[model samples]
Target chain A: MEFNRRQVLKLAGLGLTATATPGLLAACSNGKPAAGDGSVKFEGWDYEATLVQQNLDKFTQASNIKVNYTPITSAQYVQKVVAEFTGGGGPDALYVYDDSLAAWVEGEYLQPIDGLPGVDEVYSSIFPGNAEAMTYQGKRYGLPYYTDSNCLIYNAEILSKAGFSKPPASLEELESQAAKIKSMGLLEHPIGLPAQLSDTWWAWVWGLVFASGGDLFDNQQAPIMNTTDTVTKDVLTWLQNAANKSKVLDPASLQLLPVPVDNAMKANRYAFTIGARYALRDYNDASKSKAAGKMKMALVPSLDGKVHGTISNTRMYGLAKDTEVKDDAFKLLTYLGGLDANKQPNTAKFWFQERGLGFAYKAMAKDADVLASLKKFADPAIYAHLAEIARPRNVLGVAWYTEFETEMHKVVQGVLSNQVQPSAAVASLAQSAETLKKKYS
Target chain B: MSVLTERRPLGDTAKAWALNAPAITVITLLVAYPIGYSFYVSLQRNNLKRPKAKRFIGLDNYKALFSDDAFLSALKVSAVFVVVVLGLTVVLALILALVLNERFRGRGLLLSLALLPWAMPGVVNGLMWRTIFDAKTGALNGLMLQLGLIDSYQAWLTSSTGAFLFTALAQVWNTLPFSVIILLAGLSTIPSELYDAATVDRAGAFRRFTQVTVPWLLHPLLIVLILETMNAFRAFDTIYVLTGGGPGDATTTIALLDVQTVLTFTDFGLGSAYAWVITAITLIISVGYIGLLYRKGNFEV
Candidate 1:
């Protein structure tokens, strides 16, 4: 049909409206009957957008706040988030790891959030790891949405079949148990540790160093990696022996990433593996794992035979200081991170039950229903023990923490592979750490 | 030179400039702008991780490179990777191209098979090789064990030397297909009369190949060498997937190191400096290839 210019313009307008109407309706529906302009944008890699929308719909309904959730791949998101914030436009809030908190704070991308409404009550109520991690210059800059502390997740059935009812109490006993399990041919790699850079073998290195009373550096982030730190060498030697001499560590650990190690545990290739207490929820999933309902959680062995310590990891949601709508963003943060009647945040249920993440809410972890849900999969007591004895996030709180961790992984791998001796690796790392110290300073 | 240049010089040139304006603008925006910005960034002390501290530190980032151990080691690794991969791939591809160019049944299928690795994405190629070289679960180790070649599984990716060698091997395998296709195309262009003349002059197979094939293949060989050298020098994806630039930074080539510095550490200034050094090296090698090609008149019709 031939159309005049007026008719064409009218038809174009109609088409555009038809195309955009659904999105407009969805946006209006997302904003409940709240008084203010209730729109907040969340940007992150870890939590999927649909999952966040599902749980956060309650906030949208109750408070009339609309959340525009955007999920990006972790690597891309981490790099892009900085540019977005620096260029004066970005999401109202962002998900960041503990290592990156110092950088974000240095960049002035986060607001001092401790004074926000409802934050004071829950700020100190979350896990100590979570609480301390969000603090910078003695002021909280973000809210910890979830926290993870290292623990030994063991297959109870596998250990019981090998005549061990409970997991070992110390590294020596654990090594001995691994040897026994190996000798009995009950399991191939009794302790599956990923020596690869992508997974826990590197974290386990730090955990042992901490447990054995070795510090990475002092408050100034200087080079403290010396022979005086005997525990550092001892930990490295023990890991070397486990991997190369005792044959406890799976040789394939050097080749596989985290998923493969987890799968190996489910296939009963391991008696136990070192992982976060938060992850036990997934390890015990009947449909997804063979070790479901047959697993238990215990403290990562105290390598020094005295101190029981483990490294903690926390993920926080930081409010962009430049966000146009600060109140709405603060409300969204509270909705995701603040304590509820059960003291668990909306994300805690989704992260723990759906993704097998652990909760940082101490009261909720001990709450009757939460404990019951946690006990059905893995030991909730392990988290209680973690709450009691675990060291807070002890890594260097420098803007260059990511670089420091990466360099440490290289040094640790060098030692594990016999390419560099423990002493030499430490010496190299000392030099490297000093350079980092100078750079960051 | 033409009458057209003299007849309507100023107006014609103005019209020509106007006509080419869009293309020039596009090239500047897409290509020239990034190159200029990268150089500008290379002059600053800009670690995005320390965004607040960024400043125009001029040449200091370049100076830091000389004292950086990891950067030096990465350059060394990149050099070695380039040499090993380029050497092996060029020789092997030439041989394969020669064989495929010969009269033989199933040559069509063989030519298609020869270019298969080039068809696969770099990530896929790296992962495929990673699976085969896995210490315990790999098919290579399983077969070796079944053959009683060794008593236990070998940790091929654990040691620095092993990781370096395996990463180079994967790189060579991935690049050989492109080199072979180029060399094969060059071979097809050679006149059969020259080979006939060489045979008539009592030239042996090796001698004929050296005297005739080598000379005729020089242009394409140089092009392939230049490209593959640059590729090997800056390879990131395959090495990243296979070894993650590790076993204690043993396989961390300059390209991987640059990426780690820029993206992972968010040290933009230092990362750009790393990039400039790589670009300079690539430029030097490419210039050398072009000079050799032109000085010898390899492109002469």
Candidate 2:
């Protein structure tokens, strides 16, 4: 006996009604204000209120313009902006780095601000050679707001105790000093390195690589790392052997902030380690450590026993592609990136370091207060040292950085763990680099 | 109209198909479309900066991903992460659930408190753990020293193994509450009469637990296990916020890798491919678990 169609319809209706209804899902709760009329929605990370309020107040007082700020942390900033872009509500202004700049550029989430007043001037001020990299397809995507260069932060007390009056002037001298500190039994770590599997490890290692006169990639977008590149091999080998032979590096050195090498240095557990200049302020701000006044900085060793080089990175500002107020946004960029902005007495007095930002404009860099901070705290010699030898990170386009960074860490880890030789690791890295160049480029 | 028996009845096949229509429609729109689109993307050389250069090259992404050490390491770490966190969470949750199920004066408060870890936002929870694990000024090391448990402060999240272990601990702590709540609800459904009958039969506590409680709770246990396993595999925000998958790629997971690919690298094709790979694995595991449970009558209802 065949069933009738009406019976089937009734059965289906009963089954549909029997299932439990799904729960009402709420939207993600962390919502900032949307891009509003007469106000630009800006997203940044780790910008404290007092400093930001002061800077904003001054900018507003000067231009009568207001910005609605939505702050996130450095790590979350990229994710948030990407999400916003993906969702079609990206911020009108963003803070981005050179490493991840390609990501936004590739996504077409940014607008080139070439015609904006003073962009070209702002671009020219940032250590001349670095400017061309910020331009993509003959258009300026971002203006350099501030730049960073890594150098050696040493414990003056430890150095004096070990009979060294100043930081090492060469890689051989640096290693010899590290060994001397180890021999004195005054320190547990001679050098603090970035071994931690985070964003800064590549940055930390790249400095050493550049100082040794090794290139991460060549101009043709091909992998330059091969077994024959002795400089690259030497750099990786030194990091591994330093961690082992010197016995000054803590087993947990990888997990530390580049600055906290100063903490160990302060405690006399380490004599020297690589750190960013901005971190010098962090060291000064630390109330518990004893090395505040006793710390000194120097550049990483270069080839020829000449002035050591450093790795320089710039954080730039850009107008959002979809911003409603192109003129106002450019006005803000001009104020932030131009000489007029840095020369504002209030910008120096109120927001200078309180905002935990460094000076980018030539005028600001030479300001009496800002210059004092750089001269007294940040090593003057190292800045010059980096200027002479510093090279930008390998331009692998956007998709290639993650792979390159991963392979670099593995190579370092392999050497440290004794699982692979440094030369072989370079060979492996070359293979990874080759794969990336072929697939992505 | 004269005879109601003349009306036709739809067959079981038609009825079953009709019942599934809404779900099928929703799944196709929400899940299938994106998955299919991403598969198309994975075969292309798509860069966000150069949209004009997008070109289809089949299987290149998959080939590239295997040779990429970071992607491989991320997958391995993710697997280890899921297994270790799940093992820790399930055992701790069961014990807590059993303890809370007993009659007590502050039972209601205890039950809510047990579930509090699950309620905290992921980023906040991660930050709190990060501070506790900080080398210079973490509460954990400070307290440990005060208590004389260890002489020096250990960098809990800095070394390869240390970061891996502690990140797993944090994940377990964050997820255990959910497991406890689910198991507790399952415990509620067990009849008191069955236990009373067991007592009359002179059955010991262990005997009663094994015979009655275990069998009765099996259904909900299966649900909890499957859901928690999937949740654990997809864990991102907590680890990303806490460790950023570092002292170097030590804590990187497939989800975090997907993030780096999409946001950091702007290799959407590769990122989407990785996402699809994870989703496919999850689907396979869920189906396999359900099949096993059904065959064993663990979820007979």
Candidate 3:
């Protein structure tokens, strides 16, 4: 009982070893990647509750994989996912926004799909640019979930009344047609585009920038705003003219976001609106929009010939590296995003009919069955054509996407507001983008 | 009176330390540990995203701060914002406190309504302001149009100057009630005899106010000033929801930049350093003000 100091310490050491061995063993076993059982916890942003449940239930029934889905909103998606990834034991599988997918790849938080069974078919079947969007350093870490791109959705009634039968083919035609519509007093501004600093508006501007072969970043992912390039100057000049000096776009466009611009079209205040092709659901829904039957789809006006640029976003399915059930999660990811969600042929149809999202699989767009399923609602050709050219930019895959987006939007807003010259705006952005490049790199 | 010098018997001393051990441990763990850990992390490369690459870079993060144009710009913006927003908030709160201190009908209702903005969270307040200032559909635009104040709606959040000014106003509104309540309590605590004495001495309203009310309110005003400065300096949520620190980097305050650096970039080391830099700035300001007050003999009240 009255042990010597050496004896006391020896006894204490023995006690600690006995107490810590089991925990140490347990931690050591868990030190490597988790090999989860077939229970799947999936996360996504803003998916319809009932539809998502239906999909999860379907997958569960087919695969015997117990599944749970949490529908996080866009605002909470990154913070929650990053926390889960860093802290460990997060969802087994989740839909990732492309902006943060690269960050995850950089962090090695995703399980590569390059060696997964039947991955070749899943890999080859997806639309163009989708795989590239999820790829970092030549490894595919995610599959395309759903993709949406902006096209000019016009008010057919207004266009017809203004003496034109179809949407404008080129940027000039767009301006002239808009002027005609303005002169006819059909609307104060004929074309509606979101001018505010948001991803929604950036999509439109970015499309034009890409069309003219200009990019915000160089091959090395550095900021390369070229004020001298016709690509950059023309885009800004057109925006300036439309917003301030011309009747083509109203001053209101400078202040409007995607929703209000759509609303203005719904109210028949403008002839054309640049937005996701999926919004055709709302545009054609009589209950939601006043111009229900009047909406028509067309490519956004090109600077030269065909609409060569489209700004699109693809939701991706990434398996959390820490998941115990990596294989099961991959199964779930492929099932939902890869092969029409467990070969449910109606998956694409359901997405198109319910949520207005396009198919990830290129073949799904051309599938006779899928087209037949949607023939009652929208034309098959538009979705198929849009899918053929669905090229979305991989935003700086670094953690700086959020901050860069905020400033990028402001730069576009400046151009729209006529507060800064086109050259000045680009120059200002060059500095911020440089900072972002440095921060994220 | 030296507790260390007046040492008791060994058992007594041991017992005292034993009794105080829990409190001391809790303080160390809760307060001392985070502060010390933050300083350590700030000096290292502890980015969670790049965990394997993490290593001590020895004040490289701090060095990066000075050359960082964004951080420097954010600091400048925060300095201006703190002065303007805190000035407007304290003055307005004082005015309201004075008005409410007067005996009036429905003072209870007015006070309740005045506290409404405070009751709401910053996010909700920012959202409400967003809707109010929305260029196309906002009530503000509609009212201005109806009043013929302008031909069309102005992009209030889309202009740098307008955004900074409006965001400052929103900050003042969000933080005013607390300052008002403090100043009001300070005003009420001043004995009525002082006012009575000033009245008997035929002190005019302005003279009585400057001679009696201001000096009496100084202590609470200093508290208000300190708290308001800290709160206004760290504003993020409202600015995020409202202007998003934009129309360009016009409103990118130091606090917002720090949060962005950490949360957005997932660079905890750099973010921790940014947070400490802000802390140092605030501490310096607080210490300098306290020192000035002490020197001026204005520390007491």
Best by lDDT: 1
CAPRI quality band, candidate 1: acceptable
List TM-score per model, in order. Answer: 0.90, 0.78, 0.87
Query: For model 3, what is the alpha-carbon lDDT of residue A355?
Result: 66
Clashing pairs in 1: A278-A358
lDDT of 3 by residue, A111-166 (tens): 77888866677667776677677777778877776777767788889889988987
Descending-lDDT candidate ranking:
1, 3, 2
Task: Provide the TM-score of the second chain in candidate 3.
Answer: 0.89
lDDT string, candidate 2, A146-231, tens digits: 66677777778878988988887666677788788878777656777656555544666777777766776676556666744567
Tens-place lDDT per residue, model 1, A268-325, is: 6788788777566667778878878887888777674667777777777889877877
Can you write out model 1's per-residue Cα lDDT over B54-78, one digit (the tens) per residue?
8999999999899998899999999
Clashes of each: 1, 20, 5
lDDT, candidate 1, at B64: 88
Better of 2 and 3 by lDDT: 3
- Cα lDDT for residue B268, candidate 3: 80
| B162: Cα error in model 3, Å | 1.6
Q: Which regions in candidate 1 have their CA more than 4 angstroms from the true location?
A: A1-38, A199-201, A340-350, B1-19, B146-152, B297-301
Q: Tell me the tens digit of each residue's lDDT in model 2 across B72-134.
A: 888899989888998898889889989998998999999888888989887788888988887
